[model samples]
Target: MLQQNLYNWRLVILATAFSGASALIYELITSRILLLFFGSALTSLTIVLIIFLGGLSLGAALMTIFKKRISSTGLVFSILQLTIAFYGILILSQFINLPKLFDALAKLISSPLLLQFTGGAIFILIPTVLLGAIFPLAIAMIIDGPNDQISSRIGWLYTLDVLGSVTGAALAGFFIMPNYGHTATIVLAGSLNILAALIVFPAGKKLRLAWLIFILLFTIVAGLAIRNQKMYVIPKNLATIKDPYRQSKNIDIIGQKDILWEKASPWGVITVTEEETELGLDKILNIDNWGQCSVLSHQSESLIADGALGGKPEADVLNIGLGCGFTLASVLNNNPHQVTVAEINPVIYEAAQFFKEYTNNAIDDPKVNIIIKDGAEFLRTSQEKYDVIVIDIEHPMIAHSSPLYTIEYFRYAKEHLKTDGRVALWGYMSSDPRYLKSLVNTFKAVFDNVVFAEFEEPNYVYLFLASDGELDVKTIDTKGNAEKLLESLASIEDVAPNTLDNQILQKYFK
Candidate 1:
């Protein structure tokens, strides 16, 4: 009897760990899934976290109220585990339909927040509630007597669960998601839950046939999950455009080239698409399905490089982002003495190979040095001072891009600039005016002399030049730049400068 009890305890512990690990894996995957549908806004992330934790709390409360009615705690625990595993696979099958559901909800509900909350409840909350009940149910099965010891036993089980969660988070982020991709990771996590259910199966001898049937069903489901795993991946956030599913049908008609390279990183979904332009086929780089930069427009690139380099010949230059190598190639046209490009995503650097025609092989140039690191981190650590520093990262509204627009990063750029050097900051002409005002105010706070220029050819682009020394606005005006664009910067009404503490661009723009 003692040996049986010991074996049961061991099984319970193992089951708890597996449950915890699987739950955390679900959380990580669910967070990414939510981001794909809702976007990478802070509010979206906060909503996901809140709904996840709230579901756990609700499950715990339900378990507490109905613990006595459970009849067989071990059987209940095993069933919950199997249910989670089944739902994990089920959710993957329905993954692609989320956008349609979101759109429907948006049409029905006037409040965006309410619509988001409803979506979260359906996608994230229900599954998390199942996950949250495992701990309480496992505890109920283990403790035979002595109500006073219940608290300590719960604490010990909680500790084990947390350890498992930590392991799951590390493995999912560092290995599973990065190496195996999202679908395979979801299968792996669901498999863990199935394994946990099997470990606890012996505790419910009265339901032996039921357990066997469950095992067989779960095995079949796992096989189906593996076979249909391609459908399990989180779809790219193509919200700015049409639905990704529908967009594929229009790709051929539009004559856009098939994706040259694509990678789903911890940062965001990175894709390279080729499109025929006036200057022949040009490659465009997109992060999270938002078109960031491309090598198609020589005019836009020239404007950015000219505004940044300030027509300095044979001067040292630093390009914060190396997207498609357009800005870098344009900077090279001026014959800069040396050029250093910092690109955070290594995938972007790899994708650049396909754009050799567009970039003129500038990445391979002897004078150009490329660093695969975050732009802000590089600026903070680098000791070299450059005559010109160009920050051509994506718009500030993006969660990852917001860090570069902070006042602290602006100061870091200033610290790395030569006494007479200029720092050119890129903004989108189509950006929210409030965000633009905040960005300009942030730059104005960092530098005494700031100039703004707008480029309307090919694409609408905005540029802000910041320097301690006087800027030749007359020269910029002579190049057909809009004077009103510069005047808008000075006429900003009431907005605070964006700082690291309060990233106004992300807060308000989103």
Candidate 2:
């Protein structure tokens, strides 16, 4: 009997650790899913964290209130684990509808912050609450011994729980989500919860029968989720608060055939979709549902060729992003001595192969040297200076791209440039006046000379160029529109520049 009690105690400790790991894994994956529905803004992240922690607190309070009346904590803890597992699986199955739900909510709720908070609460509150109740119940289960040993037992349980949390975060971020994708990772987390429940089940004929039923139910539902896994592909619409889903032309299309290739990465979800346009086949690259570049889009080519070039014929160039490899191809066309491509997501480089015909297989070029690192990090660490540096990242409002638009980023770019070197950035459609003004001010604050040119062929996008020395405006202004564009930007005054400390750029996006 004593040996049996010792074995059960070990099992209870393991159960506590498993529960902690599963909870954290669920939280991280939940945050990633919310990032899809809510724009990847600071507000969206804060809303998720608040909802999770708040729900946990509420559940713990409720558990404490009811603890004295409960007779069988082992049974209660098992039920909580099973409940979390079942609910998590259901959410993973229904997560694809989040975009449509978000769109519906957008029509009713005018405030963006409130919408994010409400959506997060509605989606994740139950499981997080249930998760919160389990730890205290586990503590109650094992603290049935001497009063003196109870403290050490609680300390060990807490330590194991914390260690499990760290393990879960590391595995989810670095291994599971990246390799297995979101749906599979969530399923794995749910399965861990089920395992934890089994580990803590008290020995009895009736309880054993109940455990068998739970296993059967879990297997059936998990099998279904795995079978229909592809249905949970993240939506490509509603990239930001400024853009709505109904406004997209391809809103009518459904199913997963349109998604040519998709993968989840540490940075974000990298997706390649094919569109049968009137012109031809158009391949688009998207990061976290924000369209990065397209084969048919002239913006990437024009941004590099028209803006970044014209500095030196045999210039050594630095390209920040490799979307569709169009910008890299443009630089290569000019016969640069060497082109250093700094791309964060390696999956993006793989996706660019789909547009090899248009990109001239830029990723395979001998002159191109690929460095898979964050653009700003590369600039801060590298001693190599380039005659021209092009920033082809996504919009400044995006959480991942926000850092590259700050005053500090511009300074890094400046420090990595030669005396006469120039830097170019694609400011996609300066529709928001304050955003444009603040961005222009940020650029002007760092460089001696700043000039911008606007294009209207595919869509309205601005190519901004900055140099320490005088820029050849006559060469860049091929259509005689640079002067008017510069005048319009200069008219807006008293605008504060975006900096690392203030981060004013993300606000203009909202």
What TM-score does model 2 achieve against the real structure? 0.89
Each candidate structure's TM-score, on Cα atoms with residue i matched to residue i, is 0.86, 0.89
Cα lDDT of model 1 by residue, 1-510, tens digit: 111132365578778988889888988877776766665456677787888899899999898787777666766787888888888877854665788878888888888778888887788777788887887778766675577665666677778888888888889978888655577678778888888888877544567888778778877876776564332222343223322322333222224555645666666667667677666866677765567776656466556687677668889999988777878887998889999998887767765654556667788899999999989889889999999998888766556677888889989999998878898876666555676778778988999988776665566777778899888654344355556765665666768989879877765564
Tens-place lDDT per residue, model 2, 1-510, is 111232365678789888899888988888888877666566666887898889889888888778777777777888999999888887755787887777888899988788878777888999989988877777777776788788888888889988988888888878988876787778878888889989978779999999999889888888888776443233343123232112223322335326666667777777777677554766678776676778677554655465577747888899998888888888888888999999888777766666666766677898999999988789889999999999988777567778889999999999999987899887666566677788888998999898776666456676778889887666555567877876776667667999989987777764
Off by over 4 Å in 1: 1-7, 92-96, 145-152, 203-257, 275-282, 295-299, 429-431, 456-459, 473-481, 486-492
In model 2, which runs have C-alpha deviations exceeding 4 angstroms? 1-9, 230-257, 277-280, 456-459, 473-493
Q: What is residue 401's positional error in candidate 1, in angstroms?
A: 2.4
Model 2, C-alpha of 389: deviation from truth (Å): 0.4
Q: For candidate 2, what is the lDDT? A: 0.77
Candidate 1 worst ten-residue window by lDDT = 245-254
